[model samples]
Target: MSFSNFLSGLKEKTNELKDEVLKFKNKNFLHAATAGSALIAMADGSIDSAEKQKMLKLIENNDALKVFKTSDVISSFTEFLNNFDFDKDVGESKACEALNRIKDNNVEARTVMRLILAIAASDGVFDQDEKIVAIKIAKELGLNPADFEL
Candidate 1:
């Protein structure tokens, strides 16, 4: 193969590697946000269509999360939901595990809390159950629930 051709192939491979690294770096944030969304959605014992739609829109619009393909976000959210459906305690444990991944990062934790609050209120009523779940999430993140008005 010509040197030029080899260089071109190397560049292409490098670009692909960079893309994969970027995805990996953002994967935790994506999972955490989606897991929190699932928790808030299921807080009231029923996931509302409006809440689902709001989460989709948020994923599309949020700069940090928009880097991820929608399919990945949806899949993560679905997995959380399925866990909840299969067993409430297991689901919550899994979701909390994901959330705790970024707990030490104040900025990311606050962002996740905001997304959770938005999802909880999307149904037009941030009910007591939702509030309690949000508060729990806030505490798990080492954040003050009152800071989020939870």
Candidate 2:
């Protein structure tokens, strides 16, 4: 191949690799966000329509999450909810595991915490049960619950 063609191919390959890496990172974020949302939404023993709508709105407004389709986001959220429906203990364990993935990154952890808090208060009343779950999620993300006023 000519030098120009070789450079063009290399550039294309680099862009493809970059896109893959970005998608992987976003997927991790998506899982963590949805897991936190599910935990908070179910904390009070039920996931209300208000809570679901709040989460959907948050994802729609968040630049990082907006890259994903609404259906994809809903699917992820539903998957977490399904896990909880199957078994509370197992669901919590899996959700915490997902949150732990970003614990080392303080920024992402804080953002996730913020998202959790928003979901908790989405129904106009952040009750004790939701607070307790928020605290657990904060600890899982390596954040202090006190920082979030939980």
Candidate 3:
């Protein structure tokens, strides 16, 4: 192939890679999932190491969430926690807003909520606090919390 053709092919490949990266990052989805999970995990007053690990494993194994990098998941989850650590109201509000973005996609929202519930229950004790948070999240996601038995 000529030099011009080689350059054209390289550019095309670069563009394709960029698009792939964008899909993989999926900023909003990652943020919402992580934040929502963190909130539920914190319902018991703190996210135990075991609970955090469970959430990580669930995210890694979950088909819908497997696309995100572990680092990205950790970062998003931590950001929400840090905000919560600083100010309860602010953190909850911000995380809720991020989760609210996916409300339009009901399927995704329900999947995320289910994942949160699993993580909260991972320690073998899904307490009432966690259940309430899940219900709150369900409502925020435009779902009936009662459907989840909240």
Which candidate should be chosen as best, given TM-score against the real structure?
Answer: 1
Each model's lDDT comes to 0.91, 0.91, 0.86
lDDT of 2: 0.91
TM-score winner between 1 and 2, please give it: 1
Q: Give each model a TM-score.
A: 0.89, 0.87, 0.85
Deviation in Å, model 2, residue 120 alpha carbon: 0.9
Worst 10 residues of 3 by lDDT: 19-28
Cα lDDT tens digits for candidate 2, 24-48: 7788788899999999999989998
Q: Which has the higher lDDT value, candidate number 2 or candidate number 3?
A: 2
Model 1 — TM-score against the truth? 0.89
Model 3 residue runs over 4 Å out of place are 2-25
Ranking the candidates on lDDT from highest down gives 1, 2, 3
> For each candidate, C-alpha RMSD in Å?
2.0, 2.6, 2.9
Q: What is the lDDT of residue 97 in candidate 1?
A: 96
